[model samples]
Target: MQTTFENPRYPFKHHSDLNQGTAVHHPVVIVGAGPTGLAMGLDLAMQGIPSVILDDNNTVSVGSRAICFAKRTLEILNRYRCVSPMLEKGVTWKKGKVFFQQDLVYEFDLLPEKKHKLPAFINLQQYYLEQYLVEFIDTQQQVDLRWLNRVTEVTPGVKGNRLKVETPEGSYVLTCDYMLVADGANSPIRKQLGLESRGQVFKDRFLIADVLMQAEFPTERWFWFDPPFHPNQSALLHRQADDVWRIDLQLGWDADPQREVLEANIRPRLEAMLGEDVDFQLEWASVYTFQCRKLDSFIHDRVIFLGDAAHQVSPFGARGANGAIQSVDNLGWKLASVLKQQGPTTLLKTYDIERQMAADENILNSTRATDFITPKNKISRVFRDATLQLAKDYEFARTLVNSGRLSTPARYLDSPLNTLDDEEAFDGGVAPGSAALDAPIIIGDKTSWLIDILGTRFTLLIAIDKTDISRVGESLPELLQSVGVDLVPIFLFSESTDLEVPKGAMCICDPWGYVAQRYQLEPGTCYLFRPDQVVAGRWREFTSDSLISAVNRALGFDMEVMP
Candidate 1:
């Protein structure tokens, strides 16, 4: 049961604040060097915003924590230029199997559609992901990743938040216009400010065993409910990089977490699952109980919370890190706009509103999945088993078979930033507030996925379909330019080279008709996407007045999209 991994440790350097004998001010500072904190810092750096990241640890995550990275997460990482290693090193899969008592009842495909730029999910160790982010950050001049630096105290004020950061050399005073609290669920900053993440902490316990070995298992998610090896319990199996397999087995509420993680007890469980003759080495072991919780508000004065510091969910749905990455994606551009004074401070309120709504959705899904996996009562167990028994034969039953509701990009349908469509007859699934979908697009002589270029800016995804692209785009460029707008950039998309758009617009050709078919494009149709790549507004007919209003509304310039 002996296995080891190469965990890189970073060396600490003395900051000038330790000897400056006075407080130093920065635009932004992030606490914790985990995936969330590192992502926040890296995100700002991508936008040319400098940030200081302080962490007490010198190394990345120790174990294969958060092995599942969702498609949305990869896209976000792609923007920061850190997803290449992850795609190269991780195991990508889109199919999943659900088993009832060792019998494969049914299997499902996450991405039934084709021509996607990224896979549905990837399984890689958290440490590997962090290492890649750190390596990429080292190349960017805007990030100051301080190892062994800890935040001993947080003082929030109206203008800025003050932090007392402790380092190996000494403690120093640091202040920032904004303090991003990504310090994790047990956040020191949260406690220092008397904030609480209120939600139910489930009583059931589970053990995670990272097994290392060469095996013939396919790269797919395999879940078992009441299997012979673990009767009356639920188990999950996932293949990770480096011949590591993650197995999660439920141990009742009364199980001894300490004794269960010991090799003596863990080995027997492993044997039961993979026959006694199979060979495997234990890479790591840990026990945990999950919670579906979030802070009352992710924004507290000048302090903002992201990742685990803002919300948490059970691992059953792979919502933890994926949701956290999405949170930062949603916050990064909005925060950058405010920091650069391109938008009002009130725009930050939308982050709290939109992210809290998303947190509720994830928590609800995670709680439901956990409940089905571990039935609370005999009645619930009977119902679950009945649904599982009928799942293979009856298609309707499959919908009720809740192995785990997989994570997807959150749709902020009710977000205040959205301008609800006035035309109800038009439909293509790319409605206002829907997460942007990716499709193969033809640009000039080259071909690329639509998502590769869409998420980073405010886009006017106007489909040509033979319409005059220039007429469709109109004076919208001048409208944005005349608003004294340098913070937000917009791009125009068309189905042909017919985009005689403004000189300011970067035109993209979608000649393959893939993007048109997906978006249900017709003549003179235009969709406005926010900086986070969420559909802010869509119209069956394009007009400069309407597009301008939508753009102003999206940038938090005006309250509504006028007719």
Candidate 2:
């Protein structure tokens, strides 16, 4: 066996302190240039907003951490033009298998729908994702990424928040209209503000080892409970780029974290799982205790929190980075709007509402996964073993096996911004406050995706035929345009008519009615989408007054007219 450990450290760069004597003011100052921070900066830059990003380090993530990139996250990355490089380098997998001892109990597919453009999931190292984002950020002149700069102090202010930063040159003071924090789990800014996350921390620890070896195993998520190699413990295996495999072995509470990460202790575990004859190199190893915790409110006056700085969860479901990216998607547009005065300050509160809800969901799922993987008492272990045993033979028992309910985009169904259904007869599908679903469509002579056509703006998707477009053309476009909102109408052509779409809106031929079926579209139906691609409101028929009200409501305007 040939074993070696290779962990490259990121070099730190020197940055001149901009706030030496005078406080340099910026519209947005983001702390930490990790995935969340970099994504947010790119998003803001795309929206024509300038921001400064401060980071303590100068390189991408050190290890292959947070490898699973969800579809929704991929879509967000696509908006920033960062998804293609990731897809080109990532190992794509949609199938997963669960094993009890040596026998395979069940298998699952993450993405059953094939019509969508992006797959359900892709396994790419976090470092690669961050590097891709950094490349994109470098192209945008509006984004100022200052490496080797750390925020040493934070003070709240009336107009804006002030930050005292330390760099290689010296220390300086800076002020920003808004401060977005995306530091990792142990957020220094979060602690500087005397804030605390409240949640449960599991006692069990997990040893993660990244081994580089050539193997014939398919690129799929494999999990085992009480396997012969590692008895009475849970283990997970997944493939990554460079033929490096990520193996997670559950180490009981009694195991010493320091001793477990030793190469001598880890080598035998790898040999047992991959046979003694196999040659492998130890890429990286670490031991961590599971924790599910989050802040009560993500927003604090002029300061806002994003990513691990706001919430954290166990690594079982890959929720940490995915959820952080979603937070970036949610906050980017809203913050830009508020800063540009297109939206009220109250609009920022919705970020807290929506992302807190998402954080709660992640925490709940993470806690459940931790509990299932590490049963507390004898009775729980008995129930867990019984479920695993029964799942082998019975189909229904497979649902009881919880190997980390995979991460999914959270639909804000109960959001206050949603416009409830006015047409009672319409069929239910992607409703108001739900993330927009993707489908294949024909645009001109080329094939395109619905999401690709729906640019980052307020869009009205109308399912219409030739006859219905005339009626919709009467006042819909002009009314929305008058309010400075581009009503980029996407006409989903119905099969009944060869309609010529009216000017000012793009037309897509839905030959198989995939878009119509997915949206549950009725003739003349309309959907108002926010900049983040969230369904703001949907109606059975388009009315100028109704659409205006919905758009206003989505922008956080008080819809009530004063007498």
Clashes of each: 0, 0
How well is each residue in 1-563 modelled by candidate 2, as lDDT tens digits?
23232333445554444534688888999999899999999999878899999998878787787999999999888888779999999999899999999999999999988799998889988888888788788799999898888899999765799998887778888899999999988999999999998888899999999898999999999999999999999999999987888999998999999999999999999899999999889988889999899999998888899998899899999899999988998898888878888878888888998888899999999998889999999999999999999998898899889989898988887777788785465567788878889998888877888888664677888887676677787765577567555557777785434566667777888887789888898787888898888998988877888788887788788633211
Candidate lDDT values, in order: 0.84, 0.86
My TM-score estimates for the predictions, one after another, are 0.96, 0.95
Give lDDT: candidate 2, residue 301. Answer: 88
Model 1 worst lDDT run, 10 consecutive residues:
483-492
Shift of residue 102 alpha carbon in model 1, Å: 2.6
For model 1, residues 241-292, the per-residue Cα lDDT tens digits are: 8899999999999999999999999999999999899999998999999799
Best by lDDT: 2
Q: Against the hidden true structure, what lDDT does model 2 obtain?
A: 0.86
Best by TM-score: 1
Runs of candidate 1 with Cα error greater than 4 angstroms are: 465-467, 470-477, 483-501, 558-563
